[model samples]
Target: MAAGGSYGAALTDLGERLVGDVITPGDADYDEARKIFNTMIDRRPAAIAQCETAPDVAHAIRFARDHVLPLAVRGGGHSVAGMSLVDGGLVIDLRRMDAVTVDPGARTATVGGGAIMSGLDRATQPYGLATTGGRVSTTGVGGFVLGGGAGFLDRAFGLACDNLLSVDLVTAQGDQLHVDEKEHPELFWALHGGGGNFGVATAFTLRLHPLTTMTAMLLLWRPEAGPAVARAYRDFFESAPGQVGGGLLYLTGPPEEFVPDDMVDTLVCAVLLTYTGHEERARAITAPLLRLGHDAEMITELPYADLQCMLDDPPGYRNYWSAEYLDSFPDQAVDRFCARASDMVVPSPSQHVLFPQGAAVTEGPSDYPLPWRGAAWIVHPFGLWDDPADDARVRQWAHDTRADVRPWSRGAVYLNFIGREGRDRVIEGFGAENYHRLAGVKALYDPDNVFRLNHNIEPRIEPRPAGR
Candidate 1:
């Protein structure tokens, strides 16, 4: 079987025996298969094999290794960088393998790598159980967990990684390995936040918590009150209990029913709050924020699943996002945020989000390779528009806003939010020691580096060189 070419005969042989769809560049669904959530990234892979089982992933990994082809792994395909696809490589797409098995008696859930937040939430909601997941329902469980996951429940349960119990992965050598704190411990630790450098994770057994009712709301204020609102939000988050988690977003008014017709499209400061405690106590916990002067209030008691989808953005909308971690949201930082926020030029609704950091995130730096544990806020500047022509404007806006606030940042960026930058940013995503450690583990599990498409950490034979 010839396996040396881009579209090798070996791949064809493997696809024939596989149970999933094999998408080639000429296929009718290829365009949709290659499409990602971020409109800014458009790449064409040589082929995309949507895996249906762990063995299917193993087959894809073996094919990429034998063919010496660049490989990308797609879970939810929501990466801002679109690392899920490569220009001339094989993409082991996992979107079709989204299955969730809940062990409610054990308080655990074993989820397929391709499962999205909504799928997992729906499966676990019947038991009133959930783990830390992305705020948006569409985010994938695989990439989000492998990178450090933050969501409305993070403050209470810690990151998604903290709840991870075990993972089923297909290594570069085509052998399956089950990793956990007790077995293959180092590899497990690296997988916590090391991105997709180690292997293709097929499924994860995660610890779940009982999550019943919670309070979720969006509080809006005029632009003039930005400074005061920032101050109030900063103070409130400083001492808020772990049960409370959310962010303050500086955004243009939405042209929806929630806002009055006259205020539509006007700039405003919106505090998005979610408290995962008893419904009655949630009010008291968020009292400081709710009291801040605002133009409108949309607070309500909702189930955890409903709250998860409350902020879902349309799938195909154009989006450009840049994120950073701040040591503190001091008055100076707030001033800078407000200054750049005031200059948002996109007529569409763009936003600057300030998410609180700490609580479980600060337990230990060694727990996960993810930096920014001590950060006071995780700032994300999201530029949204509906037209391809406006793509340049939104991209530039996200970049400029990120640059404007760079000085106040902690020199740390969220791996999930990073785009197609090179190795330097990848190394920076995991601090030096963690990066080196992850590299060594990557070498053991995937020496050929078949999973080179993400924020890659090159597999190393020995420890990383001194300075690198």
Candidate 2:
């Protein structure tokens, strides 16, 4: 609905009823409210409802439904394809609802939907508890967990959705539900990897694990050694313990103390190894890679939360990314994966990463909609750069990276690692059977497809007999 139409009047009423502020296009914070993490996505929403509580979310949903306004849910504003924000629609901004409460006794965390990885990490750290979160601190816990989260701790703790105990969400019909194993079982099942199609997750209760001393190590090498390094990294994961996680990435070496002077501002390959124990154990586990590394190294034992921030990518970059889960990372495939790094824009936040996926990820529940977990390795190209002129350059590079690794592609993919490719890609993310099942759940809760933003799952509509 247009902002100047009946929405202007209806928006006023909705604003008064909401506990949070309702921001319109002319409002002081409208621009900031609509702004998301990806700079490439520039959209102007008609209204933005900054929801504070669960009731506020329901009210916003009802208002949007009543006025026939497109609805988008924002959590940490971190959707790479700008799924968090909608064009000329009403955004249910949940950034204000970020409050994480940790229960040390149960070793579970009840987090607000707006909570990011930092908030979650900080809350659970004092209790010596942690869960599978995103690679960086800025990623929203809701999007990450709902979309099948993968992080440095994933191999040890399993994907974020695997650790889900319960979820409190607001359906498209403006009804609040406490979904779990017992209550709303199907909806709970769909939440495993069913992005934001089912509903808006207002809160999440995640199972946590004990994590005391965590260590991180970065072994760097020149771009020429990428193929060999990739091979070694592939072999290392064959017997690597659950505590061993992280990726082999091609990135421009930053001007940090650990980066060599000559290698700075040039593309280089780095093997990032993260362990759930002390520095000694981390070194002992990754000793093989360290022996071959020559250029630079940054090894330190830090808190799990602190380690998450180490590779955090700053926002406000023109971002484009895609991933291809590999059935096998053969030496020839490794060469293709490394060769694509040359197409990436150097001195930017872009990373051509090959992450190992096995251990708990494959051994976990096979019933969930997540299909990419079974893959041996994941080739993800995360492209973040400035200047609109380089938009085509970075996009082509990310696309080419996926194409190069397609020979080893395991049919399925991780949706969270990529943006909206197409309907076929969405089906590829969730297997055919799981996709249909998730669509059935979508038909039940969001039949009208009110929540069709993130890697959308459309409701199955039965056709009528002949002409009406």
lDDT of each: 0.82, 0.90
Against the hidden true structure, what lDDT does model 2 obtain? 0.90
Model 2, runs deviating above 4 Å: 1-5, 462-468
TM-score of each: 0.94, 0.97
- Candidate 1, position 369, lDDT: 84
- Deviation in Å, model 2, residue 121 alpha carbon: 0.2
Model 2 clash count equals 0
State how far residue 302 of model 1 sits from its true place (Å): 0.9
lDDT of 1 by residue, 1-468 (tens): 223345667667878867886787767888988999877678988888888988898888877777777889999989887888888888999988899999999999999989999999999999999898898899999999999887888888888888899999888887899999898999989988887888888999999999877888788887778888998989988888888888888777887677777567877788888888665788877887777757887888888888988888677666777787888778887887887786665456567888997787776345588876667788888776778877776677677777766777787777887676667777778888888888889888888777777788888887578999
lDDT of 2 at 126: 89
| lDDT (C-alpha) at residue 233 in model 1 | 89
TM-score of 2: 0.97
